[model samples]
Target chain A: MSDTTIKPRIEKAPVLERITTALPIALVPVLAVLGFVAIGDPAAWLTLTVAGLAMGLMIFIMASGLTVVFGLMDVINFGHGAFISVGAFVGFSILIWLGGWTASSSVFLNLAAVFLAILVSMVATGLMGYAFERVIVMPVYGQHLKQILVTMGGLIVAQQLIHVFWGPDEIHVARPESLRGSIVIGEAAIEKYRLVAVGIGVALFLAMRHVLKSTKIGLLVRAGVENGEMVEALGYRIRRLFLIVFMVGSALAGLGGVMWGLYQETITAHMGSEIMVLVFIVVIIGGLGSVEGCFIGALLVGLLSNYTAFLAPKVALVSTIALMVIILMWRPQGLYPVVKAK
Target chain B: MKEPLLTLSGVHTHIGPYHILQGVDLVVPKGGVSVLLGRNGAGKTTTLRTIMGLWQASEGTILFEGQDITKLPTPEISRAGIAFVPEDMGIFTDLTVAENMTLAAARGPLDPDRLEWIKTLFPPIRTFWESSAGTLSGGQKQMLSVARAIIEPRKLILIDEPTKGLAPAIIKAMSDALLELKETDTTILLVEQNFSMASAVGDTVSVMDDGHIVHAGEMAELAGDARMQERLMGLSLEAHQ
Candidate 1:
């Protein structure tokens, strides 16, 4: 209370910190501008930007859960892709069963089919996640090497099971008539479904942020990420909190799976494994446990991939890796590293 | 003089290959401060941790209100009206002070009057309520750690090295705060290295050496007798001065 008392070393002004935080978000537009300059075509640029945004949002949905799980549990679950694939297949089955709803020209019926698919997929994947944690992840709490091996084995088994059930061949999925077309604005054309994906992605991000920042469970989770022992000492069951987080994370991956499957208009047993590469890239670029970092990292990868594919089709595959390297050189701990005591 | 609120009898703990706690017998009496003192690696920390069930006692019993609690989980131990502030202070640096305090009030929402009382005890908890705890000074974080333990009333509070690595001014402030806490009905089992701080707030004292209690008696008697302090702690109060 004394004025002469030494102040706890004054941290950088909050405004400066805010600006640094906002800097990554600014990169999206800056990259978009660079794309416009390189292509020298306004219409193509507009189309690619929307496509990139949609792609980024979907990747965010998938990577968000992985980062949270890693951040809090310190578990590297290599089999997360299993949930994605399972959700896609389960959701696809429901869609096929609701043929009447998908075939209907009415928007309400078409939306209803997609909603049901998302709901069923989330539930199925969430339950799968519970079993996965109890069976494969619980025993190897602090053993990183075993976690990687067991989870990878789990992925392989899940993929094979998909083949056994859905057959070895790729299955074609048709979009509902209501969602199949694009809306034209001047010279730029944007797909309606991609716009819808963008809406859903933003909604999910806001909801997650609100929950993590405002709720008691979110507080415990964030605290658990820093020190699980402390949370337990404070009389909360950190294990139960982690289990709930793992299930929710798996459910989100499922929702992302349904969205991505629809975007590709094709479902295959190996689709989740295939996307795992990109998801891991997003997770690494985002910083291990930070949701905001994951969101920005996803968008950056999305835009870079789209822009590179447009400008130089051959370099598209390595664009994300290249970007990650450059980013790492600039900030070794990823774009927004959570400051945790080592 | 008062009945022991908690009692640990012949507790032994094994952490991996190291038998850290050979046998720790401690008694925390009701409604006063009891200081646990010893040199580094004396198993002082292991004793507190065992009571909180962070490290399970391999042998012997821990009783609370004469009920066996030797095998309860850490959360269960805490829920049974005991709070532990670990040696590291255990402040979640990523979270705001308010969030850390909120999590510690495990029973429910913080009582408004209690929150106000805590704010007066530790001003930084209120002053930096919205700032992430990582930004706090070592002393402020220590205050927040103690504030968290008393966020709600508990039968016993276990605090380990609350003044470690803090400035002298801050240590005095912490000592004063603990002295104030001594006036309340809360029972504190404190682990301390600073003799001045220990003698300032301690009602009773237990000294450990190589994982066992070597001496136990009234704090006033030990503080007044230089020969006893030297024999038990290898250093007297005057030596620190």
Candidate 2:
């Protein structure tokens, strides 16, 4: 026998028992296509599929940070949507103030404005998360009902604050020159702004994955998620960990808000409240705390909403809710749970 | 013979409004398994919890290696060369055996020599090296907990109950492993209800009753004193043996 043949069957059949294992993260795009096909007009299925995928990518980006905080810290932040709205408004203000929605402003200045807007949103929302953790969440650790009540109060306060500053009227955002118009791929015509948003979302997703795997803080997070008391016992200040996670989560939401503003070109005080319903559906369907699950969940919801809207228009609104119920019925813990080691 | 590594004086702990440890006093010399003996709900577990800094000693001082550590957080206390193995073993059930070991090691490389030593001490851990700790038998989980503590350069190890629900044979093995660990100069504060296991591995014994250390002395002295054993532990010499 050859040396290879003499060896024992080292390739033991890979265990298929991880009921919660993430589907290949690469297949998010593929699943998005499948989603569109299931819900879109038969003639325009492919284009709608691509659009739905793009939409999913946006939702995945928005909810990624929220899910990380949820999974790792066990904190369900209701102010996540508020952060997104803040990012959109901040970005919109920068755009309108610079050039009155005209095409003459330096592209560099516009980019800088976007960055500044995102930065403002990030800092504001991050600080909000920090304070929220210190004042409301920390004292009532492991109390779900208290968390729900306090954070809902926070949401109402944040919405009122947004209205106080930006006013109740709907605000308009202009697409950058480079992101204006449409991209024709094969027989598909897609909005250039939506594509750019998808690109940004993909970049952010990659960066989050790298940080979670490579960074010391990330390891601490994984350990903390498994056992907070043990992590605390290992000399880490749990309070600091909680703060850092909250900030990162809020910042991610802020970035998502910027993307959402760029794509829709509209902002309002209720933008957060509007998208929050979708965000919760995404996170809940994905699984309570799994990033992979959130990504998968977001994309599934995004595509479900987009294609269903494209097909039935009015009836499409219930698509996300339906998918959520179906998912819960199948796997009550969420689609891709982080399986407890047993 | 040497200065005590840990000194607890008038340690009091209250969980919320109810006082758990009321004026407990004890001392553990530098290199021995000092067993804290008591019946269930007699504050034996609370005494360990208080020392490990899980519960703040409301009105007492804990000196570890000559530094007061009563006010420090549990993590800081653990980092100050003391490791705690709780009654539940506090094993991260989601982590694999290897991951659990790595988590426990915290900052250091898995010392191969130490791993080999512990593997020799508790062979089942080697056999179940990749298995999740939650799948292990109760005895095996206790071994993993002790193994996790020993993986670090732990100057002091506090094990709440190493043989709480183990069979007689596994308890014997645990006692033998702890005896070997004691030989390596690791100071262990063990809380146990199993008197035979405690007597076999303990260098000194402190009997706790109603949240206070009622009797404390060298294990040899306590073992030799039949009347003292009956009064403190409610066990006659034959029953204790």
Candidate 3:
């Protein structure tokens, strides 16, 4: 061959996935330190810090399902909030029925009542999620615009159904007697309910991380989220996986609803929709379809929301949105984008 | 053709309004590499996809083991023992290399012997067994893609453009790997543009043009005949070399 012979150009193999970045993980602690420095008062700062952790964890629980569903199915489900409202109602109603134990001083009674509420709520919302997928989301698969409109309609219908079942008036859901007060540690006080929320949130995060990392089903899920078509091509039914994921996501939303209701001591048909603003922000900020990203995004938002509210009340109103904008400006695809192999 | 393992009879595939594959008729004999060669946009990829059931055949029948599978869904078609490695390689970048193979071994756990053999074949697979697939280079990902397809005992493997964009050294390695796989009596239907590798590994060759099979013959015949090569592929074999 002559030296002048044209040869096919060779491309150097890329060292890493395009979206890999260590920055998102560091942002959580960086935000904490920033919070500490900005607030200046140790007691107030510590109190806000715990509140932020609790809030961030709850959002992570809610956003986790949506992110995975978004990743695996490529289906935009605006109706996810309905599961939250239904979950809150279902859980709190179970609590109300156990009225005999609501005022009981025993910690077992309090925990039992709460546990029962969570169980029933998950089951209820899980079933609802199944029906919603079959009846609503299934038809609009791969059609993003239609998915948005139809799922939004589903949300409206769910909200109205909630009103029909529970009445139009907002309901007050008080924490169980044992979970009603706070423990004072030095100069700062932490609500008993908030502490419980923190423990549950962290434990749940670990469990989810373990499942995604070590389990076969979790492997399929991560793969399906990245490329459902490829998953199907590999001899696995992705549609069934999508249905299972949707149901689980709905159940998690229900669980979050119950905890959120207890945390706020209030339940209403509109509560889920209201919280969804933060949930969307977190999903967007934590690259869509990654539970870890969702968790990190939730923490950043929670801390910033709390800190900004303390520092500048007006900025607090749009703090999560502002954070989302800034994060997007930095990483257009968000932190830890689960890129489909192209 | 040594008792065909797969037969596509006048198969037509449509992706939305685009009629990509227009009545493709081909036979893939058992126990060899059957390379599908075509120019860009000639519907070679669509033919493989139609057989895999990724895109449904709007018309005609696809038969494997004498069973009609044209209307089958992708998963059912795969469960019937067909594995596809798309041009993109379809590696789940977020998943670990081991996790990727585990997912492909649908029937049961990965056989230790089989895994060891595969690890030896592709060292990066063993070295990065626990690392995210994203960490691997392009050539390594392609190796994993083929490895995943054969992780379990598949009846046939379909690979699209495996050597599409790679260094010459990697191309030689891939060609050798395909030849080694042939030793085990595995059937591979490869859609490849790299003529040198295709001729080196292919036992049977089908040339496609404008969604139709223009010629099918022994790989050696096509490789030895420069006139036939120009007529079928519109390029001389020497240029590819």
Candidate 4:
């Protein structure tokens, strides 16, 4: 270590810019208030809000990986949904095996069973993601049309494989003892699982933020997303960084799949593709490769979907599309757009 | 005789159907600045890029420290101790200045002495230490780009147009920074258009036209002679010779 005294840095706060950045976050609260007013009943609104948040957080988990992958290597893996389905099925198998623990009256045993299933599912999905990147994604780098066609083909094959293993039949699952019922607050009965999901989602969002903002790996990821070529020139192998990110992203999707399957209490081989519509919406709305953007977009879509489904069932079908259109019109590049190299 | 740190022989690069660098030859001497000067589309940027291994030369060899790096992947070329600051500066705007610097140092944490020295060279780096890179002014961004290149010790640096756009004040500061950087004995292959800045820091100069080096000699020779500037800047009939 050499001796050198460095000058201290002076902090300069730019208030206007901070406000501008924070405005998108305010949209969640604004939309929630609108939702509350539109529904006009505290109980119904609260229940729907919890459910919407849970759905949003789950979608954030899934879309988070896609956005980063899209942003970093510019790979459009339509095969991403395959990992989701695989995760759900894997977790479903584990849950079925641990049925006694899940059915047990002890909350500890129930949570322990669910945790084990999630862990096993994450590993299965993470490994599958690694293989998927090497086998399917590696060949189609920078070729948009081929990436779409090949990954979609991969998705189809994965679905077929799922059928081979889990059979083509839709699998139903029962919630664990502690997670089965809803908590009554005043007049509203909020599902315990929904609340738990919201907590996990918020915690995950915070954790992800910390990683992206604090860690060296996260810094490399953020750098890789913006200018991968530059990242390579700086002496780090970006492809390796990108591979790690791809695996982690896939693992996250796997986690999301498990959560989503449990939430719906049903698992189908085609479930991943069916949810792709919402995932794509969140990715597009969040700005490709932006985790924060994905989170907010997920929440907005989830909240709006639930609110619209409650307020106007007919409008709910097109609400997500309309939201995307409106957001695109407003920001064009999506919220929190990554400044790409020209 | 000054030692050659890098040498490119008969380098040619094709991007899709367009030929960017065609039959280019260059040599960067160790321990000082070698400026690659050219007008628009003279393939100065492409030459720097080819040397950095961003774009693989379709034909020919690029030997850095005598190691043939013609077909090496960009990351490996960089890992061989060559840093590149592209024309775009390639700053990750979303990341803070501190984060950008953190990514620059490939091996462990940055050296405190070097960090302090860089802060002295580019004052804006300290001012915007925690600020998002996107928030910086153009001059500050350029400073950050150069600072990033020197964040760690490297044998060679390939910089493309560090003074493309800026006020005279910023250019002077950049010129002063490069002059001071020369004292540390880092080999810099700078692609630039600003003649004054080029003349100020360059120990050796190579003028390019139509993807070929038209003139190569001491920077003083080009700086002292007005006729050479007009002859090589454009309409270099001797490029064939």
Candidate 5:
């Protein structure tokens, strides 16, 4: 064959070769974990998987708000974790005040409250998202620096406000009675709340994936993420779309917050502030603008941290940050970077 | 002649601290191509952008179909019988050709005649119906942009650089399609760098320099005046580069 014919073949090989080679590299981590379990302790492996899955789900919920804003509107909302905190508080208040339940209540009644709490918090968070976009975000379009500073300021104000309203004392939120007990599977004894959280997370991931794939609004959102200005030029009021995205994202974070509250059974005025670091780490590790990335990153961080705790409980927290730094060093844009095919 | 489809008077625009359009005055006779010719950054695209409310005119009156649209939003301005094709060939690349067309159709009814007319004008667009718009060649994107503008009941369409960075054959095709568009009731304001392309299709030619219209006349009258193109565009067409 001529050089011209050969050139195309050479160029095509790199793309295919990269994927084929990378597949084994991607499997190495999973296989390594499996091998460690097969030789040593299965309990350790199971514990790591449950912890990783739970963390991954939580990260997916929280990062949905941040990524949606970044992907769709190119707006970075640093105050997102505050929305999660708000959702937690709201859910707790609903269970305590409306459902008339306590830590000792039946799991079925608490479960009902959880559903109702999720509904109320989602709506409330959605409205807050709309208002935040309209009031704070509208004026600073395309000004990333301004958005960062303003949203950070919003976070500070929100944190202080939460402290003022909820008081300094950390409050405890109870899981349902049914979910309080531990389930023994093989040699691993996992709490019912942790398992339930994993289930909720999986459901959320599937639902969000479905909405993005199937709906007209989802179509608009995907298009908007790539080219919001064009979406506006096409005569669809993009402001409204931004608001919708903001609300839905905030609600997702709120849902995550509610879930976290149930898992920890504790809420504090600075609960949002404490988790913001981990949430951002998860988002950055997953990929800044991808949902799937959030899940993967969350899972990696969760499992890594849990395993680290097993190895050295005193320094488990450092493991997630170490993973984040290592990932950044390797892939500056994060794993599974949201790149469009040229 | 019947009332002009679109009219602009003393349209002044400022971007940030820079004064862009000083006082561009022009009128588009109903059902004709009015070309706005200028050097780079001479406010040709800015004039179209401002008219479409992409940048609100600092001072001026833009009337489309005998209605004031100076204070309207960009989407509202588009909805008001006026469509703008930006200089960059603003095609939503992530969307499929069909999806892009579908979104445009949602703006207003895409009459069968108009759709057929466009398909006849550019067959490549029809050929790549299901393909992603980003995958299209530059010339095809230009065709899609122009096609999008004229898809509805637009009294006037403003097209910016319909033949920028295109193969010679595609440029000729675009020029021919634009001329055909003029034959229909659609009025057009064209911003162009290629003088020959403008001259071939434009019924009336308006020359802009430093944000002001320096000359306005018929295509023949303007093209005959070599000094005007040199004085305004800073390059003489007769002289080979």
Candidate 6:
């Protein structure tokens, strides 16, 4: 063999590709400016902007798992909402049990109560996710139609189960005392809980990006997303990887459920189902399996919804759908399509 | 011959409703290149896939070093020291070339000496280490695919059509790479449509018609006899020339 180094021909990506890559992130600020202009009130814009960011973060938390699961496993788990509801109810139950801590004026105690709720909900939902994969997801791996039908069926069953345990009526949830009030900043007032949600969402996004970029497991996952059979052929148990991703994704949805439950100060069996519409919108807008795309899409939906709800309350419901339509028109495959061996 | 490194006796594979491989019996000797030649839809890829356990052999047995591997899952078959380079090259387009190689190494960090040796075999693997596998041209992707298979030492490798769709120059380079690879201790079961490329590196040859091996013999013997090649393949190697 010749000791010659064959340098790869380097070609910069064309202008179109660069623009598409940056479009999702760029849309955030552009939408914010559009909101600022349309609302015509700086204070309202600040409040809505923070509210949208916080809402987007929560949606990102819930939708992140679905996008990954869809990307890697090709499983459309409609029952993912069930995990959210389960987590919310489980977390709320803990808070109810720890009423003393939740009611305490001390920030530490209140935070502790909320933290315990989140931890317990995550564990419960994580285990539920494991069972969900084995029982509901494993058998319907390649059949998309069956996956949708069965997982939807699973969602209905889960809701019924939640109704059995938590009852049919909605339960009132109070944010922990320390997280209840708004923090006035300059002329803008932001809810303390929303700020916390934003922080958690940012942390989760960074952590997910880091893991996918640097870790061995992350490498397998990204590879598996592109070609799962190749990942198996390379001697890694891709099924095991999928199972782990499913469980973690379910846990994240559960965590989001807890946050959202407190944000609304209410919990119900139907809450997860109701949120599923928005979650689906985010996943679709983000591209089916791209996590970064999901985050951006979530923010877009969140801001658009908040802005529309404030500006034209009647159009709020259809605003996300309109956004999805416009986005799909621009990139039919979603914002960040995962390039796989077709 | 020395004890066969891998053997398939009356192997039958069923993919979904299609019974692709009726019975494929093959013997790959311990350390030389064995080329499987066949026309399209003749089950050459299926044979490799079955050996790698990507497609389960519904009936019969696959023995790797005398150990039954017919029931093993794809990952277990790979872990048992068998590597497969599928027809599509199986490069993870979303991942960088380095990530692709790292995933294939599976055991631990890539060996520096082996990496250097591979760089000589396929320079693109080194030059484009940080580049996404998707950016590589078809020929470079094929090179990366083969590089990944040989990244770690293995008992045997099943490669499907390494020279397919490559430019004449790249095919020549690939032929040279395979010839160099033959010098190593690894046993290879290669599936190729290009007779010239097969004749160049193959130590042994097997011809498949419709999933069953119709003929098996020394490559030199097959290469020298055009009549036998025509009878088995319905086309002679001379036809390409």
Name the best candidate (by lDDT): 6
- For candidate 2 chain B, which ten residues in a row score worst on lDDT? B92-101
Q: Model 2 off-target regions past 4 Å? A: A1-43, A96-120, A338-342, B106-140, B167-170, B221-231, B234-241
lDDT of 6: 0.92
Candidate number with greatest DockQ: 6
- lDDT tens digits by residue: candidate 1, A11-71: 7669987888778778778988999999898988888889998999999998899999998
Candidate 3 lDDT over B1-241, as tens digits, reads 5889999999988899898888899999999999999999999989989999988899999999889998999999999999999999999887888889999998899999999988777766776787778778788898899999999888899999999888787777778788889988679999999999999999999999988999998999999999999988889889988
Candidate 2: clashing pairs of residues: A233-B75
Give the per-residue lDDT of model 4 (tens digit) for A1-342. Answer: 111222233445689967878888999999999999999999999999999999999999888889888988899989889989999999999999999999999999999998998899989999998988898899889899999999999999999999999899999978898999889999999999999889878998999899988899989888888888999898888888878888988988899889999999999999999999999999989888888999999999999999999999999999999999999898888888773423
lDDT of 5 by residue, A1-342 (tens): 011111111112467767853542363278347535653688767766686678767767878678867878888778887788888888888877754543546766667767898899888888877777888888998898999988878778877777787776789887766778778888987777788889988888888778775666776787777766666666777778888888888898888888888878899756776887888897787666667777777777767767777767877868889888988887777766553322
- Candidate 2: what's its TM-score on chain B? 0.96
Selected candidate, larger TM-score, 2 vs 4: 4
lDDT of 2 by residue, A104-216 (tens): 55656656666676777777777777777788678767776777778778778878888898898887787766667777876667787676666776787777767665555
What TM-score does prediction 1 earn? 0.97
Better of 1 and 2 by lDDT: 1
Per-residue accuracy of model 2 over B48-78 as CA lDDT, tens digit each? 7788888788998999989999999887898
**Tens digits of lDDT, candidate 6, A132-230:** 999999999999999999999999999999989989998999988999889987788999999999999999999999999999999999998888999
TM-score of each: 0.97, 0.86, 0.94, 0.94, 0.88, 0.98
Stronger candidate by TM-score (1 vs 3): 1
Off by over 4 Å in 3: A1-20, A339-342
Error of 2 at B240 (Å): 8.2
**Model 4 off-target regions past 4 Å?**
A1-18, A339-342, B235-241
Ranking by lDDT: 6, 1, 3, 4, 5, 2
Poorest 10 consecutive residues by lDDT, candidate 1 chain B: B118-127
Model 3, span A208-288: residue lDDT tens: 999888899899998887888899999898889889999999999999999999988889998898999999999999888
Off by over 4 Å in 1: A1-18, A339-342
lDDT value for model 3: 0.89
> Which regions of candidate 6 are displaced past 4 Å?
A3-7, A339-342
